[model samples]
Target: MTQRPVSNPAPANNPAPAYNPALSGNPQSATGRAYPNGNPDLGYNPPGVRNTDSAVPLRRDKPVIHNYACKDAAPGNLAFRWTYGSNVAAKNRDPRVQVVQYNEDSFVLRQNVCVHWEAPFTYLLFGNKGALLIDSGATADAQHYPLRATVDAIITRWAQARGRRAVPLTIALTSGEDVAQNQGLVQFAGRPETTIVPKPLHVMKRFYGLANWPSGTGAIDLGDRVIEVIPTPGTHQDGVSFYDPYCDFLFTGDLLFPGKINIGNDRDFVASLERLKAFAADRPVKWLLGGHIEMMFVPGKYYPRFATYKPYERVLEMLPAVIDEAIQYARDVQGKDMMLIRPDFALFNGVSPDQRTQVWPVGVPNINAPRPF
Candidate 1:
């Protein structure tokens, strides 16, 4: 494949290594790798297994950006999520929704950049029969974000592009009971030609053919587009990562986004990361796109919780090795009470100084795991 034309991530301390090209059959592929193949350092090692003569394998190709999203903010609450970044209503543009066409077949829709900082991303992947709409946003009111109308617009566009044939949308949350992803469910529930994936854990487990938790893997075939449902239950018990081999895009709802990582069961979280690491290795992955972006422009920096607008931020596309770094970080600090902070994200059991952290579960409990907040 020809080299992709995109700006390289800006650098920071211990920034993720570049992608190695040795496996790509081109010595120049190593041009983008974080480490060289013959370095005798990088290899697959499970938790508690250390490569004595090798360097710790950190995230590969973690996006490095130039500056903070809010560096220009003068003072006051303006810099906070309340008001920051691109003005949604500058001239006459509506702030209700922003539809970005990544390609004819794939599109990304988000609540107004100003609607909510956590304006979780909603992805629509088109196929021969219909489209798969992943995640709702944090808003319920149509006037505020127009979730339904925006979806119709996408459907219309998709149909027109394909010789005027409609591609209906099948709605599914990245995880069950996620307020940020399910708030818009009510808006689409009454619409025609829409099927909402059942929210019950057992129902979902059966629907996806997942026989058991953590060990079971399932998939959904959207006509020709196939999506693997890799059970990732750390950020939330029911949380799962959707891997789209068609687009080489892994939509990790909350398992590993740009923001703070709120872990419920550390064991499950670590195990989940390990699972993703192995899954990614077997496939050709282009981008690991998560539901949200919280990593600020500078490396390892992040906007505080609820801070909406991020002017200087890392690219939405992240490296798959982030799973590895997170796993290693977890293994290196097992039961230490210290939440590991990395350049891309922070890990914790949703516990902090004053707030009450959720009781981290012992084993993979049912989907009823309480949240950190």
Candidate 2:
């Protein structure tokens, strides 16, 4: 029998709020909304937090699919396409800053540029003591000459706002991809010294050819404020979620998004979600800093219900259901002697196919199983 994809059940009666033009169209002006600046009281902070030495699981799962259609989609996946115009050339123009205060000290600064995407490249800046920049969009593509120029302008603007010529900024990465980290680093290299936190040394080495990238859990002292790196592996071995203690904000790379967690890299995708859940349980996350969406949060007046539905929490709560569905999908495909699985899903599948090979790992048991309903 063919399996159907599982769809999350809609919340009872509480049915998510109707799409309001104000909130949907003009999120910046939405009142009492949590994120990128709305209500300070709604922000999250753990009252008494303690650190545990437990590390995320490292054992790998066996390969399950060989000849999966989805695995063949990576190179052509529309999701990875950079249809948005380049950022390099736009950087040459003057920098513009728009600040949205989430609370008394935390704010998101958006620097506009001529990138293909309409949303501006956002810099999540905090005002505790020093400064922290979460995910410096695209900064190094030769085509995005404007993007690199724009980032430089923003850095200068940040320095001016802090009232220091050489204010140190800590750049945090969600992954080690060039568009996410390298490009931005190359652009910022000329500036005064800045500390960059990249997780899972292996990815850094493979992607940037750097053997010693920052690793492990630690606090980044930025003068007055402190940013904590909560290693959440899964999207990539080095994927990490950052928390700005003073500002009560969480920057969850691609682990969790408003609608769906991007499953481009499935194994790390699921693992990353688990890590995020544990991180949130220990530290209350007031705001969610996403890569594509500037900011996101669960909406409601009741604090407990709101907390129960925070984006990361919601993703964690729904993961088991998602995984079960994926497994069912594998079963159905196997029945048909065909396979379809997300390309990233192949990571933990145990079969080694050359990364360059287009063929999916074939002959694994129930490798082509169908998705569960």
Candidate 3:
């Protein structure tokens, strides 16, 4: 008998068409094209980065998927009222980070079309004394990502808003050291005020106060705000997840994204989920924001693999309840067999040590690039 994919009985949040594996993640389809349906103007075509109208007025049949993530309704002031406007700006005008003011002191810096196609997201959160930046883009080259400049601009703006000069900014990685998010190290080499959390396990162990290497927990302070850092190493050897207290949001990097979730260590990944479940018991989590969203129009419909343009993207947030599903499905599948593809996330099969450093399509710069910082 052939093994089958396991999913929840309660129908997917996105409209059906049901599940079709062929178009979701079979290499070519993994990075497939998901053009913008409403208007062609916002297509993410390199020189002129593509974007969707903040008020996309999505097709009636295709209701807002986020509204369905939870039934009880979202928490107070935790909504993403933002609209993602068109991306018709000139090529030279595009910056590596598409900065969106999310909250009073919270800003989201999404990677641009000109940078890595993965188009990973990094966040800048500000408090009284300083701020925290999560994840560098796919490259450290200032010409490419220019993450440091963007941060500097934001700091200046923030200082001006508060009638004060800029404070120190800390650059941190999720679940730690996944190469796709660490190319910006060189850009901040000489900055005296910026404190980038080192990626090595030893350094992380000390920084996070994790006497335990793979599973340690610590707190990160951004002035008046404090975020929890939990070591979740299955996604990568040094993977870690950060929690924001003010908004009751959890910023999990690739660990909880909508796209391909490749697990490097099975034990660590499952344990991380359990850790999250326990952590949530105390904190009132409003929204669980993740690193990437590869799915498009329909349910389980993902964009092509390695493609820089994600024209038909889903909402960037997921309900905290999905964590329970992820944890349960991860446990259910493991009890039956080796690796199983769960509904929300995948329980990736463990890989060899040599294979850990290698990513598909071979030799991709973001995957293979050497990090000197």
Which run of 10 residues does model 3 get worst, by summed lDDT? 59-68
Q: If the candidates were sorted by their lDDT against the true structure, best first, what order would they fall in?
A: 1, 3, 2
Model 1 clashing-pair count: 15
Query: Using TM-score as the measure, which candidate wins?
Result: 1
C-alpha local distance difference test of each model? 0.65, 0.41, 0.63
- lDDT of model 1, residue 261: 73
lDDT of 3 at 96: 57
The local lDDT score (0 to 100) that residue 322 gets in candidate 3 is 82
Residue 10 lDDT in candidate 3: 40
CA displacement after TM-score superposition, residue 119 of candidate 2 (Å): 4.9
What TM-score goes with each of the models? Answer: 0.69, 0.45, 0.68
lDDT of 2 by residue, 209-286 (tens): 333332345466554455666666544556666666554556665554322222344444455555555565776454
Q: What is the C-alpha lDDT profile of model 1 across 35-60, one tens digit per residue?
A: 32233222232224432212222222
Shift of residue 31 alpha carbon in model 1, Å: 34
lDDT per residue as tens, model 3, 30-108: 3323431112222221123333322222222321111112333223343442222223423434555777777657888
